[model samples]
Target chain A: MRRLLPALIALALLTGLSLLVGATNLFDSPLDRSMVLAVSRLPRTMAAILAGAGLALAGVVIQQTMRNRLVEPGLTGTPEAAMIGLLGVTLLAPGAALLTKMSVAALSALLGTAGFFALSTRVPRRDPMLLPLVGLIYGGILGAAALFIAWSTDLVQFVGIWQTGDFSGVLRGRYELLWLIAALAGLLWLFTDRLTILGLGEDRARALGLNVRQTVLAGLTIVAIAVAVVVVTVGAMPFVGLVVPNIVSRLWGDNLRDNLGLVAVMGGGFVLASDVIGRLVRWPYEIPAATIFAIGGAAIFLWLLNHPKAHAHG
Target chain B: MIDIDHLTLERDGRVILDDISLRLPRGGITAIIGPNGAGKSTLLHCLAGLLAPRSGRVRVLGRDIHHIPARERARLLALLTQSPGTVPRLSVRDLVAFGRWPHHRGRPGPTDHALVAQALERFALTPLAARDVETLSGGQKQRAFVAMAYAQSTPWMLLDEPLSALDPKYIRDIMDRLRDLAPPRHGLTEAPAASRSVLLVLHDLQIAWRYADWFVCLKDGKLLAHGPRDTTVTADLLSALYDTPLRLERVSDSSVILPA
Candidate 1:
């Protein structure tokens, strides 16, 4: 509880900042301010927070499930698989309901993540870096295929927005799907110990009376839903999951049940702060949160690689 | 006691354990000794109910091990695999406390907490209970894992090379702790009243000979010999088992196996 205080305070500050700093001036009239706050600012801030928390939770789940520290939903072909599903829906039904598209994307992302899990088993454990590299390559292949389809179908513009995470377009009705992450986070909380047992690998988990296959599928299902929902709502946030979980694990240990709340809070803070910064970087004009996070997250990733604390692979 | 009836296992169309049949008496430490690829670890896995053989059955304490549900089976047997993969950055107490998982599922009760504390105390890990498992030395890490298996409070412990990389001090520390936990055996027929029966795969023949009350030797996936240490283990059998000359010699009232 003591550890959570500072984080909660910082997140509260970020949430307020996210609501205040935006393209529109909220001070013109009380009615306009309230209208803008309710319709645009509130929804965008909530979207960033929800999407961040969901991605971080997904990141930790996949990392523990695969027993690799450097992996997350973005690298595991999840977003690309989700993009393909979205494209397929766009091509087939052209006007399919958003819910239908989301379900399809989530299912496709599950299959894609399952493919990475299969490939992960064949990867030798001699190097911890190898699995993430493999995930990168696997995601690259899926992404390349998605890009080709998008180009051929003349849906390149649609694909571009989904590929980069931005919150400028978020409104009350559009980003409601991201609330699925909150439900998924609650679901993840129930499976906390099982997910931690997963880090022990197959033999140990089974020895502990855990159904390893079922638990893994459950975990990956959560990851797929969370990732797909975020992609569909605000586009892909690359390193929110990757960086938040790693930082939380470094400060606190890997006891998923105990540290989950902190991870979610910190994750929300990380992305919301990035979004707030994106709004203010060039006063009136805006930058995508994904671009800011990519620059910051890449630097942190490099630092984590060189740090001795990151030697959990051994 | 473990009963193996015509057990055979094949991997990738190649037989790993071919028609192996043996009964390992319960109540004491039984070391499965063999050369590399002799399927010692594989047989241990079968005994722990983690692996199912192709042909036959394994019965532990009168129940078909393979048929038992995983949760019930966990209450009966605990297994510590060799190099249990990546150690999560969990505290030592938390890792050991996972032994009570089968009982509490996820919500650990007071009994679970008490047992975990007892396990920590018994393993001399109370001082390091709050430390992260990944920060421990190789031997300390091994002890923490053993403490976890111990905390499971099962009737049987099937360990695969629990002492693989430990130095002599840690090996002796672990062996001594295990010796204290196993029921005292007077003869092969004496059944243990309540204590755990340990079955381990050992690469160190000296440690095995020092601590194990029974021996199960395998060569090329076949049982070479199995009985009390004094009756079943012979210099000639040890030599044939490893395809190298070995001698059993006594020095200062203790028996030792050395390459000859």
Candidate 2:
């Protein structure tokens, strides 16, 4: 509880700031302010928190399942694959429901993540950086494919919307799908022990009577759903997953059952804080939380690379 | 008892273990010893049901190992492989707790917690229970891994080269623990009454000769010899197994092997 106090406080403060700092002043007109709060400000804050928490939880699962800390859903071609699925559905039915698009996106994300996992097995583990580098390139390739498809279909502008993660477009109904991440978080709690066992490597996990393949598939599915819902709702929020889980693991430890709630809280807090900063930095205008987090996340990642206690593979 | 019948494993056209047959008796320490690349680890893996033999089957206590569910197999036997991978930032107690996974399947009962505590105490790891596994010395890490295997509470424990890079003190410490856990003595205060049967792939012939009651010697993936250690582990058999002359010297009621 003591460890969580700061994060909870931060969350509360940022949520308040998020509600008050928007273009329509909260105190300017009582009815208008309440309307804005109910419709736009509240949904935006919830979106930021849910997306952040979901991505961070997904990041932990990917890191644990792959036995490497550097990898996350965004780096593993998940968002790109999800984008590709969205693009395909848009082209095919043109009027597909949001749920339909999300399902397709989740499916493709799972396949792409599974492909990356398959590729990861062949890459030698002598150097840890090699896997993440491979994932980055894999994500790049998938992104290129999505861009190519978007160009041909004349949906490049739509693709651009998803390429930047902004909560400005999030309204009440538009962002509820991200609640699936909350469900995913619950699933993660249920499977926390199995996921931790996976970090021990295949032989150990199998020796412990865990169905290694089944556990991995379940973890990847959760990651896919989380990434896909976030992308479908608020675009791609890069680095939240990677950065939040690393921070929590460094502060606490890798015992997922114990650290998961803290990881989610930190992740939600980080994104909410980022969104608040993005809102205030431009004043009446806004900056995408993705851009701000990418800048900060990259710096921390570099420091993590050079830290003496970092794993040799890094 | 564990039984292997005509078990053969071939990988990538290279025979790892060819036409091997053996029966490992229950309730004692059985050592698998051989030259490098003699399939000592491979045979151990086959016995543990980690590797599937190309032709034959392994049976543990009248049940075919591979045919049973994986959780059931884990309950029957525990295997500690060479250079076991570590989960970063994991505490010693948490790693040891994983051994009870097969028994409780994630919802660990009080009995599981009590057994983990006992295993920690038995391995002298109680002091380091809260320490990260990565921070431990190599010997301590090895002991933690062994403690995890012990915590599994299986009747059979199969270890592969668990003493490859340990100091004399650690080596002796682990051997003594294994010896005590074998027949005629229960493993720990919290453990069930059944004595554990330990099978390890060992290169240190001295430790094997000191602690192991039964021997399974292999050469070129074939069963060279196996039986009660005193009777079958003669100087000539040892010499032929290594293709080099090795004499057994009786020193103060315990024997040591030296190059002849």
Clashes found in each candidate (C-alpha, N, C closer than 3 A)? 0, 0
Candidate 1 error regions (>4 Å): A28-31, A305-314
Candidate number achieving the greatest TM-score relative to the actual structure: 1
Give the alpha carbon lDDT tens digit for every residue of B146-187 in model 2: 999999999999999999989999999998888888853223
TM-score of 1: 0.97
All candidates: DockQ: 0.61, 0.45
Residue B193's C-alpha lDDT in candidate 2? 45
Per-chain TM-score of candidate 2, chain B: 0.95
Per-residue error for B52 in candidate 2, Å, reads 1.6
Error of 1 at B125 (Å): 0.2
lDDT of 1 by residue, A1-314 (tens): 66778899999988888888977777755457888999999999999999999999999999988989889998899999999999999899989999999999999999999999999999998898898899999999999999999999999998899999999999989999998989999999899999999888788999999999999999999999999999999999998889999887886789887789889998888888888999998979999999999898888877875774732211
Q: Please list the C-alpha lDDT of all candidates, in the order they appear.
A: 0.90, 0.87
Candidate that scores best on lDDT: 1
